[model samples]
Target: MESLAPALGLGWDRQLGPSLPLSKVTVSAPEKDKWRRIEPTINTIWPIVEKADARAREFVARRRAATRAAA
Candidate 1:
């Protein structure tokens, strides 16, 4: 299954090692404008967004830890 991933152009290996830290990326104001434009709408449902983000982070952390342990 792992061997088939590369042939399919599905780079699963990229997610296996240490995760990228968000702080390492530098985003310019223009790049962030899209989100800024939606700020009002996002604020209306901020709680839902926060909850989903937390769940996603938890999922990634568990997956990364499991992969490292296997390695």
Candidate 2:
């Protein structure tokens, strides 16, 4: 990230973001069972999730290429 910082014009001065914290909860569960309880709902929302994933991939690809060029 520091390597790409200059190319991307990011710095403390710009303060682009640290929007999401690098933290995670320990998800111990019969989470599969819990998820199965909502299987129908997940099926319904999965398409939207897929679309968002595709968009994010494209955005990241573009950003990487731009950073490479700037480098």
Candidate 3:
């Protein structure tokens, strides 16, 4: 399986590719590398990052839904 990084698309900061990208790119760039970029991980933070990412995803999802509903 592949990571969601590819699905996030171009132009967003590689280091913080959203909690997720549900809309079209707000900015455009030619390079593809930026999309596959992941946060630089170190051994100690592996489990900690996983837990944080799970919460981030849930929070972002709810926020997106609320924003869409309000719009």
Best prediction by TM-score: 1
- The model with the greatest lDDT is 2
Q: What is the full ranking by lDDT, best candidate first?
A: 2, 1, 3
Global fold similarity of model 1 (TM-score): 0.49
List TM-scores for all candidates, in order: 0.49, 0.43, 0.38
Candidate 1 local lDDT, residue 22: 48
| Candidate 1 Cα RMSD (Å) | 9.6
Q: Which residue runs of candidate 2 sit more than 4 Å off their true CA positions? A: 1-24, 29-44
C-alpha lDDT of candidate 1 relative to the true structure:
0.63
Spell out the clash pairs found in candidate 2.
none
lDDT of 2 by residue, 1-71 (tens): 55455444575444446554534773654334767877999999998799898987787777778877877
lDDT, candidate 3, 29-64, per-residue tens: 445676445435455567878889898788667665
For all candidates in order, the CA lDDT equals: 0.63, 0.68, 0.56
lDDT of 1 by residue, 1-71 (tens): 35445433356644444544446464743354668877899899988789889987786676666666777
RMSD of each: 9.6, 7.3, 12.6
